[model samples]
Target: MTASLTPLPLQGHVLFRSSDLDEARARVAEVFCPHRLDTSGGGAFAARHHHLAGQGLSLNYIEYGARTRIMPGELGAFYLLQIPLAGGASIRNGAQGYLSTPDRAAILNPHLPTVMEWEEGTRQILVQISRAAMQAHLAAHLGGPSDRPLTFDGPLDLTAGPGAALRRLVLWLVAEADAGQSPVAAPAAGLMAGQIEKTVLSGLLDAAAHDHMAALGRRRAAPRPRHLRLAESYIEAHLDQPITLEDVAEAAGISPRGLQLAFRQHRGTTPLGFWREVRLARAHADLLTAAPGVTVTQVALRWGFTHFGRFSELYRARYGLSPRDTLRAAQGG
Candidate 1:
């Protein structure tokens, strides 16, 4: 599918309400991937699902009255984070099984087949993230490629720390959607929508317990000057892409902490500072030869500078003129 430029926008507010098992199943497939729901608590079976989605992430509220078992099969390309709002559920991810309550969350790893059994009155807030987008973000964060699958240590504790904070944010976003005031629903939130999705994914990677969590946060020995040169070269080559500090560190075959220490000790600036300087220089060059009808915002965004004001401020500091001034002069010349 050709990706939609706008994250969900207003299209995801559709509510699915049904009492028939077959009916609910069909509606859910439209919101999430195909899944089978079977009731074990008996009586009248009913389900409710309210889905909100962006380009790379989705937030949903789901409830199935009467005890139930949902087989989502092999997610294959997505991770479903289930946070119960009421009651509890037992989630099986591969050999490990997690019993999640209102204070806990279950992150269903994509590679593992997942089975979720809910209590009779359970309700949950579900966040679905695209696997490719998430994995790419994780690799970028760790400053190296993820050679193996990111395995969660266990269930997430929502009562404290990053997990609690992430839950609050999700709830706030959900409340916004419920009130029809969500940023994703705003027409002006195009690029901003993508940022929100990326932030959510990054937060999950940062907070959630995973095999890579330790490595990403671990401090390593400072990189040699030769390694710093390799990183600088990599940054110069891939300046146009979304290159992070981690990318540079990985290219230099060192940890992010080590790369930062080396840059400070040698260059007197952080790796990110050096990277920003290079980008500023490149943006200046692009502005000089920018095509007709090109705006400063166009040039700024083209060079991976998202915030126009910040870019202008940095550009002015480096070149002794605002980006607009530089572009204006280039056009005039």
Candidate 2:
């Protein structure tokens, strides 16, 4: 039998297990159904049957048992973080489309119409986090460019990594809540629901960065092999050099202006900015693997940092801590 559990305004959790197709459809339509739903390019997607739930976030899961095509239209209710547990589903957003690998996931903007297709015996998880919830979690990180509704810019591989662990956790939480195993399961589910939302956001950012790089690659006018090789070789060899735009440009045999534009177009960052990030990362790595009594200054200097004051400032800003503090914390001093 299909059962509908109306979620609380800010939180809810539930699980369903049923063989009755009609009942399952009824419950999904009633509980987590989209608000301003419309469809074009008519077709059916699949018969969904699975256990699902969420608290303080709208998480839904289903196991598909058929092949079908979903019409395109805005969900008009909430953003969806769709994770396929088994089998696969394909999605398109007018520009580019991708298929979801098992364990790998995709994010769909509910405000725009999307097309989804699936095969028989498919199982998946869908978490619908509200606009308010997203704004709350992504306060400072939601700057620069707006890149949505164009493609799925999130993790395409879902093995035993953090993404897979999260998928397992969400499944368990929903199942436990549905079974009412513990009286506190509802609240506990709420806490985990927040964590799931954050993970999805982080993965999406990675995918967006990947998409940006791919687009830049396609836009290169002429293959300036010399300039590209010069910039790359200089950055790698002299990462410990007080690398600057002028320095890198000179090595590349190109004007500083040309160098800057090339890095921005191809590498997504200017030469100097990318160099600094590389140095700081190297410093962090040294701190982690350096031998005993390896001071932060030693690590910084090894990575081409001459100004302790400036290096420490940038390190702290990028990594959220001073170098000394990181080494101490790492060694448990």
Candidate 3:
């Protein structure tokens, strides 16, 4: 579908900038901290921002001054991603503190009170994506809750591995927005924003999973398409063979969790869910056109539906019709 966006001023809606520390601090207060600010009356301040919000997702790109004071209790509302473009920042979340530098990015979930202090003469690329957006993406792709903000604390070192491509894409996106020549047309821009939101989310989840793997002393090798295809084909060939996730994992010579992960990465669906859908689709086709004398029970059994009543119920639920109704409609056609 074609996409579109509600255009907003970068400085006002998506980005805020002011040389006057007071003005800058005031701007921060409008969204995060709603109180008076203490800053020099006059200073050289500049800021730029651009963003696209689409399909319950928001992607904001912002660059601001090198040194800025983040108020306390300001991070209790939104989940923010801070990517250093030129300098660095020291962030303190109560007792937990970390340094965010140009080579590294820090993710902050605003549920906890925290403060940020940007380094002097530094520039950063900030992407403010919303939680709802992450959830939507998860629903579409992974079929689960996308709760919890993920923090990857270190130099993304995107210069190597799978992260490199993403890093380059981010840089390009920032540049296009700044140049006023973003090829992302209105709707396309919105779509791109959504994709970026999902990509970031997937990265964070994958990183978390990687951390878990590390804890388990498991190192993941690069995934191979052939391996995924072998696993999928195995499932398809044995759809009615009384299968278990463990069996599939064994056939593929991987752990059950690893099998699940592979299926998610390759097919964007759980292995068993995909198998059930396949069976249901086949049953649907058979019900639609299986000769004049075919019965609903026969179609169901042929598709590995062991329980006639349950099959009929599930069939009706999935296709909005009983198997008999589907046959009748097909004959009428």
Candidate 4:
């Protein structure tokens, strides 16, 4: 049976505003988990929470004042990654402790007791995931069953690489949900929503330091022929969607770097180059058949080309004629 997940509001929850302590605490707890919250920032507690929820995953933006502390009870079923957008937090998870900020994120381990102290005026976006969902998903990607629990070390530095991409994915998903453009919110998004969720899951699985880190990051071993074929097929099918190299790797059950090497070895081009080639090819066909109302720029955008001049240059270089010229000829103008 195909399980139906409650869709996110394609346009996310509007800024949900409240200023009462009892209400804010209860509300935040309801969205997350119930726990003890004592505020030493004793002034009135005002907060804004913008949220979007999908299958077993959710993203939220929250800002509330606190000078003392918070004891969010153990989340035995879910994992959380808390990242501040403004101030920061001093957090204690079991024996682990860290200072989390905009440039860093705290991966709140599931099945552990937790406490946190957020500075005054701290605004943060929290990503929550079901532990079972992620672990099972990870095991599938590794092509086997996992014997041990996945646990992270500490705060994730979001300044560069996959960490940065992970942060951007959360923000972008929130924005897309808010605009009703994401698979979570758009009726036609269908399997793409699940695909996006899987992509996020795999990205974090690869980025975070966990017990499964070695297996996930094993780049010395190359991907199998079938894996390479799967990655290429995923890229070709999703060219018009907002997919990244990591997404393609996830679909192929390989790390991004490993997938790149496989592509270079087998196809004589980088994974991204292959994607560009595929998109350019389709955009060319679209330009040739463009109707009177259709424009060259529109065709380029449809193929995920964001830069008009760059797309034109590539289009001209590949087709030996500009996209506009092709469209004009198709229109008989």
Candidate 5:
């Protein structure tokens, strides 16, 4: 029996459609890593790829109309989350193996060796996130650099819980792209696009079982220490000025290392992470009630955020909307 399929995603954003196996392999390799693609199953070879690129990630829809085997070895620089829309694929990553279907998705860690056999007629939505971004994000959450590389368990259940929510979020992004309202579209939407990318990365980290889950859970359960409140207040008061970990520690009356430990334990983030959040909140507030002549760039610069793009991204991630959007709403635009 044939599996049901949704309408093709990124229909208006086709990167390529080709019947030549070599051309398909070469083009797809330019986007992802180079891989061995073989279609020796006697099925006709036709491939299509549709893509939407963002600041730190990309969303893609791809299918090879023929049964094909792909050996990409270690993906080295990025992670790939494959959600099958129709039919299925057999995926082997590292020492784990699974049959990925519409109800079950596959997440490939950057360090894992991957070999996949995509069944004929199978179609999938792939989310690609860079390793540097993922590691930096994880470090922010852990409050320090991880001793080991971030790795996720292979099979993800998309029927319920976090996995289900992740699936819905990805589809919603695709829908937004289809409607020409995606944050990934114009350069003006760069900030929003960054937030959306972070959301996807964070969603995947939360949805899949990963190496740092236990530490994350422990941090979440830790009681907020009294010193954190003092540090937070200090950060809030200094939103308009430059500050450092030592300064925050001094204000909190703790050693720098001790303050970092406290922040990690009680706040689940580093002191700088907390400070960034506070600054972002301040920027958000400013945007919400800005004077007619105020601009996003001006507001961001006022909050000690010199990189306008980064400030916008961080602001959107914290406020659930772009700074420009907030300013527009406040201006009754």
Candidate 6:
């Protein structure tokens, strides 16, 4: 069957559509990473890719109307969650191997080598999430950096529990896009897009089996100390202003030294570090909802971030996009 005859998802957002093998490989590579694509069985090739690019991730609908093998060694910068909508695909990510279907999905870790073979008539919805954004989310959960790279134990079960919820969430995003209500497609939808992106990332971490589950559980089980709560409240209130450690310490009714000790013990970071994280988060939100004529400098300055270069670097590390890019996206540029 040719791609034109196939009922495709995200129909209005066509990134690439072609029957030429080389052209298909090159065009798809522009959106994803470089990969080798070849016909594995004696079948005709027809390819279509429909895509929606958002703040920290993208939603894609792809189909190759032939039996094909794809070898993309080490994704390097992003994770891919692929849910087959029509036919199944055999996926091998590093030492793990599985068959992905409608009831079962596959998440490809950025650090692992992957090889996949799609059956003829296979079509799928793929979520590409930035590695930096994912790592930052994980760090927020763990309260510190992970000792090793995060890896999921797949294939993800999409029938019930968190997996089912994740599947629904992804599909909902697609539905919204198709209906012209997607934050991804709307100008000035940054805050909404950021929230959706964060929700999806968080849901993926919760649904999929991963390396940091135990640590995450432990962090959640631990109760927040009274002083820490007070300090956090103070930080939130002062995010738009320049506040020092002494101010937070005083608000929490603890000495600066004691506040530092408590933060290190319970939060796995310094008091200043926690404050910086909160400030960065606020800056992100501001950028996402920024109006036309608002500049990255204005957002950073309003958020108490004085160092422009440093703020941009940290913002990219946390949200996987530069501050200017986020602002431009919010302004519908």
Per TM-score, the best of the predicted structures is 6
User: Candidate 4 lDDT, tens digit per residue, 27-126?
Assistant: 7777677888778746557666776667767777776755637798676657898867778899898889989988999898776789998888777778
lDDT of 2 by residue, 197-306 (tens): 57655544444323354533333444545796688788879988776788889989999999987766555556777677667767876785767788988898888888
What is the descending lDDT order?
A: 6, 5, 1, 4, 2, 3
Off by over 4 Å in 1: 1-12, 185-188, 219-225, 228-333
For candidate 1, write residues 230-330 as lDDT tens digits.
Answer: 98789778866787888888899999999988766555457777677667767877887877788998888877889888998776544445778777877
Which candidate do you rate higher for TM-score, 1 or 5? 5
Question: Would you give me the overall lDDT of model 4?
Answer: 0.73
Cα-based RMSD of the predictions, in order?
A: 13.4, 14.6, 13.3, 18.3, 9.2, 6.0
Candidate numbers, best TM-score first, in rank order: 6, 5, 1, 4, 3, 2
Residue-wise C-alpha lDDT for candidate 5, range 11-78, written one tens digit per residue: 87899999999999999998998999998677789899998887667889999999999999988768
Per-candidate local distance difference test: 0.74, 0.57, 0.55, 0.73, 0.82, 0.85
lDDT string, candidate 3, 1-333, tens digits: 001112322322354545565666566555444533332223344544445443433345444444456655535334556666566777765455778776566666544556677665455555554433443344344322112232334334444554555556555655555556543334556456555556766665443222222312222333445656677788778766568888778877788898888666544556676677567767877876778778878887777889988877766545445777778877774
Worst 10 residues of 1 by lDDT: 1-10
After superposing candidate 5, which stretches have Cα over 4 Å from the reference?
1-7, 223-333
- Looking at model 3, report the run of 10 residues with the lowest lDDT sum: 1-10
TM-score, one value per model: 0.64, 0.44, 0.48, 0.60, 0.68, 0.69
Spell out the clash pairs found in candidate 5: none
| Candidate 2 lowest-lDDT run of ten | 1-10
On lDDT, the candidate that comes out on top is 6
Candidate 6 per-residue lDDT over residues 30-141, each given as its tens digit: 8888999999777789998998988778999998989999998888768999998878999999999999998999999888899999999888999998876787788788
- In each prediction, how many residue pairs overlap at the backbone (N, C-alpha, C within less than 3 A)? 0, 5, 4, 5, 0, 0
